[model samples]
Target: MSTLSGKTALITGSVQGIGLAVAKVLAGAGARIAVHGLADAQQAEAAVSAVRSAGAPDARFFDADVRDVAKIEAMMAEVAEWGGADILVNNAGIQKTASLADADAATWDAILAVNLSAAFHTMRLGLPAMAERGFGRVINIASVHGLVGSINKAPYVASKFGLVGMSKVAALEYASAGTRETGGVTVNCIAPGWTETAIIEAQVQARAEQFGGDTEKGIADLLAEKQPSRRTSAPEEIGELALWLCHRHAHNVTGATIPVDGGWTAQ
Candidate 1:
């Protein structure tokens, strides 16, 4: 039998990138998927279809901005029709590259709202249902910045660090219970290093423009400087780790900020 067979997973911001990768991985393991996106119904539907194609028996789309608490609550109600959530992946986040001195209030607020507050909103609404069911998995897609600082990314780092802290507390609060006995949940965060996503590509391009060099060279330089492997990570790697964490054996691994970085945090 599949590891997550019969479980229902709600993955926020799963229309693309790492979020989509996680959805595909979980669905491949035989879980029902709730593919979420901000507003693009068509994209959300496509995500649902992709999950269904990946061996999920059931898949649905949830359209709601993660930054909005009320909308998240409403989406949870809609998701309740699918028998509530057994897995919750908080992957909705935004980033802006600006040093503290250059960072504006608007940019900081936007980063915090989407990257940190959104996760909190989802957890607040989803936790009770998880606690009631006595079984749940909450995975937050954090960043290596959560453990280490990065240049021109103050807000992103702050929000991710906060997420890591929050995840640990939530994990401890629920760790004393178990699914077989009380349906208790495990909460963990995955902190990815330099990933080859659209966001990273944009950063590469921006760096290239700033230095008057090729984007490929800029990207390589970034890897050489920050990542010990001197290579960018594929989205599937994060997806695989997330899948592993959802298995029954991973129950004891909660409250941990697992780094999937290329030894970025190790250095």
Candidate 2:
């Protein structure tokens, strides 16, 4: 039987990038998928179609702004009515770079709302039902910055670190009862390093503008200093790890902040 043959997985920010990749991977593993993102009806449908095409037994899209708690709650309620999710992947996030001396309160609020608080909201709304059902998987897509520091990304770092702590607490709360021999619900986090995503591309562009319009030099310096592997991670690779965290074989693994970064945190 497929690992997730009878499970339903809900993934946020799933319209593109890491979220989209994770959705497709889970769908291919036989999980009925709920793709959530901030998008119009047409765009949402397109994502649903893509998931279905990737081999999901069933698929749908939920549109909501993660920064809005009320909207997130409403969306989760709607999802619960449609048969609650068995796997919740908190993959939605936004990156706003700023030094502490120059950080704006509004930007900090927005970043925290999306990157950290959205996961909290989802877990609060999603966990009780999971505990009741005796099965659940909560995976947060964090970053290497959660484990180590970098320049000019205070909000992002703080949010991811908070998320790691939250995941550990949730795991302790929801771990299956029974001498730790059997597996039930689990919460874990993945801290990815630099990935070749739109976000990274935007950062590269910004660096190029700052460095006399030399994009290659900007990317090279970024890679040389950051990822020891000198290569950006693939979203699909992260997707595979996310799938593993949801599998029955990984039942014993919980509360860990696993890094998929290319040796970024090691330094």
Candidate 3:
């Protein structure tokens, strides 16, 4: 039997990147999927289609901007109608690489809204349902920035660091409360190193323009300098780790932060 044969998973920011990869992995394990996107209905539908094609018993699109608390609450209500969320992947986040001196109020607010506050909104609304059902898996897609520091990414680092702390507290709250009628829940965070997603593509292109180098070479230099493998991580690597965390064997592993970076954090 599949590890998640009868489960339902909600993955935010699932239209692309790490979120999409995680959705596909969970679907492969036989979970029904609720794919979420910010405001693009078509993208959301396409994500659902991808999950279904990957062997999900069923998949549906949800339109909600994670930064909007009202929208998040409404989306969770809709998801509950479909039988509540068994797995929640808080992967919706935005990043900016500005020094604190250059960071403005608006920039800080925007980054916090999407990266930190969004996770709070989702967890606040989704946790009650999870507690009621007594079974749930919460995976927050954090970054190595959460554990360490990075240059020109103050807001991103701050938001991610806060998320890791929140995940640990949530895990402790729900870990020892399982009953026969209620299933157990596990909450964890995954900190990925630089992955070659659309976000990184944009970063690479920007760096290339700034340094007068080919984008490919710029990307390679960026990876070689920081990542021990001399390569950036793949989104699917994070997906597989997330899949493992949700399995039965992972029951005792809550409040932990797993890094999928190719030894970037090691240095």
Global CA lDDT of candidate 2, please?
A: 0.88
Q: Estimate, for each residue in 1-267, the C-alpha lDDT of model 2 and write its tens digit.
A: 267888899999999899999999999999999999988888788889988988899998888888888999999998898899999999999887879999999989998999999999999999999888777899999999889988899998899999999999999988863233334788999999878787778789887887898988888778888889888789989999999888766778899999987888887
lDDT of 3 at 79: 95
Task: List the global CA lDDT of all models.
Answer: 0.86, 0.88, 0.86
- Report the CA-based lDDT of candidate 1 relative to the real structure: 0.86
> For model 3, how does the per-residue alpha-carbon lDDT over 119-170 read when each residue is reduced to its tens digit?
8888877877777776788999999999999888999999999999999999
- Model 3 stretches with alpha carbons more than 4 Å out: 179-183
Q: TM-score of each candidate?
A: 0.94, 0.94, 0.94
The candidate maximizing lDDT is 2
Residues 95-180, model 1: lDDT tens digits:
87978899999999899998899888888778877877777899999999999998899999999999999999899888866664
Off by over 4 Å in 2: 177-182, 210-214
Name every residue pair that clashes in candidate 2.
none
Error (Å) of candidate 1 at residue 15 is 0.3
